[model samples]
Target: MARVYSIVSGKGGTGKTSSAINLAAALNSLGEDVIVVDANISTPNVGIHLGAPIVPVTLNHVLTNRAEVTEAIYKHESGLKILPSSLSTQDLGRIKHENLVQVVKQLKRLSKYIILDSAAGLGKETEASILASDEVIIVTQPEMPAVTDALKAVKLCEQLGKPVKGFILTRHRWKKSEMQVENILDMLEIPAVGLIPEDKNMQKALMLKSPIVNSYPKSKASKAYFETARRLLGIKEEKGFFERIFGS
Candidate 1:
């Protein structure tokens, strides 16, 4: 069955877009057809993240009926498909948030998985994406402000009648200064997709305009994202440390 997942965050800088990109890339590497949509129509970043900050046709065009969804779809070198939004401020005023549902319907016919990188906040754009998705994935960091915002997001999902697949705790470093993992899990009271460890290679991948899954496939963040995808698909995990760490 095909599934659409909206990677949402209550606040910005929670690594929401990064989680969406890496998870989609990981799912693609595992032989699934995945399309990542930059649902942050106001301040989109998927294009910027992947180095093509500008494109001929974008999600903005699709929303405005200027272009079909298929026309706006761009192929990444990693074989993952990306549907990015316009960077132009002119396009923002023209976008109709409700049209996303229909656009997503069109995408469902083309791919097994659709990952919507939602706007980093509780905005109408994020709500539209969440409403159009089959499941919602909350992204947050190991901090009170982020977690509190994530709780609000969880409640929002509950109110909006969206099923939260789980939460992704990103940039986690097991330190005395950071919130303990146990406390976070207890506070959120939701299933955990996985924890992404802090990895310096993430910055390198950003510099290379590529996802860590492709740029540093062996890195901790990449591996964690892969594991997270496996969990999403209900794939039984390999128990061996060597296999989990270095499997083909």
Candidate 2:
């Protein structure tokens, strides 16, 4: 069965876009057909993160009725398909946020997994993404500020009647100041689907305009992402060395 997942965050800089890209790549590598859509129409990042900063056809065009949803999808070199939004500021005013669900529906017929990278904050695009998804995964850091916003995101999901699967803790360093995984799960009342470490290779992957899973497959962060993918697919596996250390 096809499932559409929206990767949302309470605020920016929580690694939401990176999560969407890498998660999609991970699933594709595991023999699933996946498409990562940049539903963050306001401040799009998936295209930039994937190194295709600009494309002729974009989600903006699909939203504005200037193009079909099928026209906007571009397959990454790694065989992962992506539907990126236009980076132009001019398209913002003309966007039809209400049409996103329709585009997502169109995407569903084309792939098994549709990963929607939503805009940060509870904005119009964010709500549209949530409505378009079958399930949502919130991404946040290990700090209070990020976790607080993540909690807010959880409440917003409840208010909207959207089912939130779990939260992905990103850039976790296990520092004394950072919130622990158990406490975060307690506060948010959700499962920990992913616990990404603070690895420098993620930045290097960004610089290379490739997913960490593809650019640095042997890196700690890459392994975590692949593990997260397996968890999402409900594949049972033993604790990885990182999972043992992180204690998730």
lDDT of 1 by residue, 1-248 (tens): 77999999898999988999999999999999999999999999999888879999999999999998999999999999999998998968878999999999999999999999999779789899999999999999999999999999999999999999988989989899998777887888777787899999999999999999999999999999999999888897767532443232
Q: What is the C-alpha lDDT of each candidate?
A: 0.91, 0.91
Q: What's the TM-score of every candidate structure?
A: 0.95, 0.96
lDDT of 2 by residue, 117-217 (tens): 99989888899999999999999999888999999999989999999999888998979888988789789998888989999999999999999999999
Which is the leading candidate under TM-score?
2
Which consecutive 10 residues in model 2 have the weakest lDDT in total?
Answer: 239-248
Where model 1 places Cα greater than 4 Å from the true spot, the runs are 239-248
Score candidate 1 by TM-score against the native.
Answer: 0.95
Clashes of 1: 0
Which regions of candidate 2 deviate over 4 angstroms? 240-248
